[model samples]
Target: MNASLLRRHRGFSLVELMVSVVIGLLALLFATRLIVSGEKNKDAAVGGSDSMQNGMLALFSLSSDATAAGWGLNDPMVAGCDTSFSDASGYALPAMPRAGASITPLAPVVIQSNGANPDLISFNSGTSQAGAGSIKLFADYTVGNTLTVDSKNPYGFNNGDVMVIAPLTPGSGKCTLFQLSGFGPPPNSTILVNSGGAYRFNAIAGLPNPYKQNLAYIYNLGSPTLMHFHTWTVSNGVLLLRATELAGAEAAGVSVTDNVVSIKAQYGFDARPPGPNPYDPTPGADGMQITAWSGTMIDADSDGVAGSPGDYQRIAAVRIAVVARSKNAEKPNSAGLCTATPVAPTVFASSAPAGVAAVPVQVNVAVAGDTVSWQCYRYRVFETIVQIRNAQWRP
Candidate 1:
């Protein structure tokens, strides 16, 4: 062998060494890119998982309350053209009967009470005559009517008294209404007219007003189910729903977490003047009107809307709206969930980008569309039409 050939074989050319280094560096670069890509993918998966969890949590919270929209109502407002929960808010009644709570009407629970059209009321078993009974009052309910108290204990009533009719049988919450004959103790014929107590009603769900006598809970549709009912007496002139000092809802099934800042509604009553048909709009006279709602009920109705030939209903119905704030936010007192201002229902709806219906939407992305992640907050509304099927008394 030649000495030069042996030396050449023993040592690598500079080009070979350089090529080897370049190849090694290229391999390192590719490996680094793969590692980085793997890490990025892992992070993306984790972020997606967290977003799903957050949404699930929000859904659970909304579901719990939404399902119970109108619960605990036994003979709720009857389903009718102008009755039930829908008549007022065009929505479902709350499962529970609490203040600032309402639903749309399904039927009309007509009211009446007068010489020819008597106003009736279901007896309160706990405090009705005979302890508990079901009686019907008739002030020509079919036509029109109203009433005034008996000058003696005229306005406002006591727990148990002998003033008007009683339920003929036992009934549920609606047992408070019925039409029976006869007036208090004296059953007089000479002193005819009875004094009336401005039977004003404040059904957070757009129910009838000032429950007078001769009223009926005509629940003629849906399954015969029982519901929970309660009363918020105006003890001492201040209104407050009897409630537990907790997050629990009132008898009008509704709930709120500490995370919920506030929930409120307004009552709008139709008004009319003194004249006759198609009366004028008075200040706050039309049948105990309630409107300008914002978690509050002001005497907006001018006490004019009658319940007779003029109109068998005082409060035509109410326009209920609510405002809720998120209890928790990234920043202290930050109203990122929703503006802290009272957004009018009409304005809110109209202000929304056009082409959207006022209803619950189920979106299922099609095969072709923008593919991106979203984290948005929404307030759900549930509504239904229920009626006063039967005003008969019950257990």
Candidate 2:
């Protein structure tokens, strides 16, 4: 009884042990698969979210600067006179046109640095409009370094602050742009007495009677700012914001946001016939329909002239599109020379020129040494229409 009972009660046969081992291995394999799948999904979701943030930030920055295409220099009291701009503020300001027969004011907003590729846009504005603080002039002076503000106490102004005094009254005076030496009997006082030399605002010809008549404003352009010229573009898969004082020249680009593949822009010219004056966007029409929507300059007068007064001045607004992509390269996606499908934002009724069907822009990207398809990466498109404020104010 003892031998038989002991033999029957032995733990189990080798076959039973083998079967149990196989079941355990299968369960472990299933669990491993579930964990791996979950991790992959999480990575994709996180990557998409990050890409969206980057795309959004880039769009916001570009749109903000575009809205301010033409600000402070809308119409200077003195026409075709020289004005200073600030460069230390990390922006690229526009330069006046070279001496010519007719006074050709610099285009408030200009797109340069590329023909059809990534385009760069630049413009000028007041310090406060450009995100810098501003102060009001308390009283007017014939000529002096001392600038008195209406406030008993000067708020948010510093010693090295660059300031601009624009004429509130039509015949008051010219807009004076100058840098502050931060000099005053009492530092940072209500009256900011710049230690620098006198401003050349009144030196120009055709001076109206009184200098500072009404509420002449004092704006902090920036300490080292001559003029604020803000530029936006895309290079090396990143969107950049560059600033410079000279025209058509920009320093090294600063990466404002990442994963930006390309930037496309179109100009809207006001070329409608003289009538009730309807300002509308026609997606796929030529001539008076869309007027001219291209990277190149428009022939606003249709006089076969380039860079003419009628051309640049007729630009009413700008439409821009920014494309961003995911950072992570998914395993399913193989990389080489990938062609990103066209991406158009809602603002654009069509991508191409007038009469042409709107299509997603085809982006040719080089992703070498990676086995991934361009389609494997997720992309986000941001687009908007920016109305040139200064241009609108024009009669």
Q: Which one is best on lDDT?
A: 2
Quote each prediction's TM-score.
0.28, 0.58
Q: Which 10-residue window in model 2 sums to the lowest lDDT?
A: 200-209
Clashes of 1: 121
Which stretches in model 2 have alpha-carbon errors above 4 Å? 1-8, 75-105, 113-117, 126-226, 244-250, 274-292, 333-360, 365-375
Cα lDDT for residue 85, model 2?
33
CA-lDDT, candidates in order:
0.26, 0.54
Query: What is the TM-score (0 to 1) of candidate 2?
Result: 0.58
Looking at candidate 1, the ten consecutive residues that score lowest on lDDT are 116-125
**Model 2 Cα lDDT, one tens digit per residue, 1-395:** 69879978887889999999999999999999899889878867877887789888887877787786655444322112233332332343333232233222344566652433566666555453344345566666565556665654456565555555555542233455555554456543344333324322223222222246346666565433344566677777778776544333346767787777667666666665433333322112332334556555655545465544445556767777777777875555243443333332232456444563342344444334435665667677777767776544431
Clashes of each: 121, 27
**Per-residue lDDT tens digits of candidate 1, residues 127-227?**
22222222233322222223222233322223212222212221112222211121344442111212122211112211222333445322211111112
